[model samples]
Target: MLQNPIGISRLVLASSSPRRRELVASLDLSLPVSVLSPDVDESVLPAWTPDETVRQLSAAKAQAALELLKGRSGAEGDELLALDAVIIAADTVVALDGEVLGKPLDEKDAAAMLMKLQGKRHEVYTGIAVLQSGNGQMHVESKKTIVTMKPFTEEKARKYAATGEPLDKAGAYGIQGLGATLVEEIEGCYFNVVGLPLSLLADMLEPYGIQAI
Candidate 1:
C-alpha cells in the first residue's frame, strides 16, 4: 500500500475555475480530497494593486470555504467539523498598460483587448493561497508570466473570438486552448499562462506538509 505524509484527510479546492481544478487534480492526490466552489464577489477593488488583488481574492476564497465548513453539513455527520482540511484557492488576471483586462463584456470588448495585445506583450498574474484550518497555518503568494501574441489581421481575431472561448477568458484570450495559435512566446511559467503555476503552487504547498503525487 502507498501513503501520503501531508497529514491531511482531504484537500479542498475553493474555486469555480475548471482550469484550476484540473491542475490540482493532476497532483494525483489521495481519493479522499474534495473539491468545492465557494461563492465570492469577484469585482475588482478600487485602488487595489495587482499583487494585492491576487492575494486578497485567494485569501477571501479560503476564508469563504472555512466559513462554509463551519456552518455546512457533511456526509460523515450532521454537525460541522474542521475535517482536517487543507484548502487551496487561486485567481488569475491579464493586464496591459496598467489596465486589467477582465473577461470581455461582449465581442466588441474582446476585440478591443485583443487589438492591444496582438503583436504586443502583456502579463499574466496568478495568486495562490493554501490554508490548513485544522492547525490555522496559512500560505499565500502570487506569480507572473509575460506572454506575447503574434500579430494577425482583424479577420483572424474576429474568427477566433466567434468561437466564444475568448469571452470567458481573461485578457480576452486563453493560451492553453484554441488561443494557443496566437501566442508567439512566453517569458515565464508556462503553467501560469495556462491559468495555474504548478511548480510555484507545489513550492507553496510544500511548506504546509502537503506533497502532490
Candidate 2:
C-alpha cells in the first residue's frame, strides 16, 4: 500500500456499529483503518436535545477511545499508539416531533417505535467527531436528515420488527437494509439515515488532512 502523504498514518474508528465501519471503509482512504469499540456510558440526560445528545455522545466516544489507545501495552498497542492516527467517532438518533427515539429495548418496543413513525415525518441527526491523536485536537459537527415513513399498519410494523433488523438501529429501522421498505422518502444525506453521513464526514475529515476524494 502507498503511504499517506498527508501525515495521517492510520484511521481509527471508535465505534462498534457495523454500518459505521462499512461506511468508513467505503471511503477507501490510503491509510490503514482500525476499529476500536469505545466503552462509555451512553445514557442521555433528559434535558439534552437531539442535536446535543448525539454531539456529546460522539465526543465522549472519541475521548474514551483515545484513552484506551494510550493505556494499551502490547506490541500491537504500542505500534498503534505510535502512529499519527485520526479517530472518527459518531452517534446518531431519530426524532419524531422532537422526541428522540433510540435503539429498541425489545421487539415489542421496536414495533411501537415503528407504529409511531409510520406515515409521519421524522428527523435523523448524526453527530461526528474527528480527533487527531498527535495533537489531541478534535472537531465535532452534526447533520440532520428529514425522513418520511410510508403508511403501514401495526401488524406490518410488528412483522418488520420480528425480522430483527430494527432492534439495533436508531428509529427502529435501518434505511440501508430491509427497513428501506419503511421509508417513503428522505430530504438530506441518505447515508445520514443509514448511520453516517458520508458527505458531512468527508468535510469534517478534510481539516485533518484526510480527504475521501
Cα lDDT tens digits, model 1, 47-92, are 8877778788888888888777656645446342465777888888
Write candidate 2's Cα lDDT for 65-130 as tens digits: 888776662445575453478889999999999899999999999999999999999999999998
Candidate 2 Cα misplacement greater than 4 A, ranges? 1-6, 73-83
Worst 10 residues of 1 by lDDT: 1-10
Q: Worst lDDT window (10 residues) for model 2?
A: 73-82
Q: lDDT (0-100) at residue 213 of candidate 2? A: 92
Q: Give the C-alpha lDDT of model 1.
A: 0.80
Q: What are the RMSDs of all candidates, in order?
A: 3.8, 3.5
